[model samples]
Target: MRTNLDFSPLFRSSIGFDRMLNALEAASRTEMVDNWPSYDIVKTTEDDYRIAMDVAGFSPDELTITQEQNMLLVSGQKTNGEEVHYLHRGIASRSFQRRFELADHVKIVGAGLANGLLTVDLKREIPEEMKPREIEIKTNIALPKAESRQIEAEKAA
Candidate 1:
């Protein structure tokens, strides 16, 4: 199933938003999305986010997290310890890698694994210069002393 989204109007009206629109378009075209180690994205506050994934068999040492240019990569690989033969294995022990495309200014705060769940925290920090500020409009102007005296003399006469 294909859902068409037209961005021609956005391109004509907006500036410096082409990257965002392109990312959206690429995300929409992505196929065979990974479902392994199910995860949830939660908004803890206005500029904070939390991502929790089910990593039952993976340990802290086996997992690796890295961030580069607005992209977050998480991978897990089980080390070779001892060989074990199981009659019926229910839990998956295979290595897997997950990629998450984060928005601009978003940074990973921390990550932790607890109770078969791996949670990653993120925070968005916009620079002070980029933040909106009130521009003071100059509405008050002083008249020259000569012009003020002339007007007063005319009024008196």
Candidate 2:
């Protein structure tokens, strides 16, 4: 006999099972994506990041970079002629499109394919309005409006 388990409470909190499930689903989907193109994302600084991918057989002319709907998409297709292959094959050369979900205000700086590795640099620009700045207050003033106004008037008279 199986007993019914209530999962209603899991959805009631902020970091609930829903968020976990979403993260899990995203991770699983990304894992199952075209594995021929593997990538690494690293945070280099406070607001800087780098995404490097292994693209051994791909050339700079075969790759494309685009940003659509806040997603940074990197795709590659090798037009370099295909050889009717041998008894064994290791390097993969076809076509692939890899997408990364970008956070708000995160932008792609540029991309380059070098030495068989494609590097895509990213920068998160926090607007001056968003970054916190120190605000100072002068609370030791002697003038309290009414008295200061009377003193100004007396001086004027």
Candidate 3:
């Protein structure tokens, strides 16, 4: 089943969020994608995150991780190896490509492959200018130079 979404109302109040909404809509449409390798996403800290994927029988060199803007791409290609006569094969060694949409300020920190699991770390580093800041507000206790001079003259009179 597929459903179309209208974001015209949201566009009136939001700017520069079209890409993100498009990513979400695309993901929703492809909900029936093949679940080749399982994965997990965990928040390690306030600004840190980790993505772990199962890549059994796949080596680190055979996997490729690429980041473009707010999109993260992870793909694996298995190379032809020595043939082994086996009556049954259970483990899957097929090529796959996964796309992950990331939020603003989120970036890939690092990645590692261990025990058939591929872990990718991410961190959200908000720049100093973008971080929340407290603004200092001044009261109306002080007046302009002209007003101060006029008040002084009135006092002298």
Per-prediction TM-score:
0.77, 0.68, 0.80
- Best by the lDDT measure: 1
Clashing pairs in 1: none
- Report the number of the highest-TM-score candidate: 3
Query: What tens-digit string does per-residue lDDT give for candidate 1 at 99-127?
Result: 99999899999999999999999999999
lDDT of 2 at 123: 94
Candidate 1 has an lDDT of 0.90
What is the model-wide C-alpha lDDT for candidate 3?
0.89
Model 2 shows how many backbone clashes? 0
lDDT scores for all predictions?
Answer: 0.90, 0.80, 0.89
Per-residue C-alpha lDDT of model 3 across residues 45-149, encoded as one tens digit per residue: 999999999999999889999999989999999998999997999999989998888998999999999999999999999999998999999888776566334
State residue 16's C-alpha deviation in candidate 2, in Å: 18
| Candidate 3 off by > 4 Å | 8-14, 137-141, 145-157
lDDT of 3 at 148: 39
Better by lDDT, candidate 2 or 1: 1
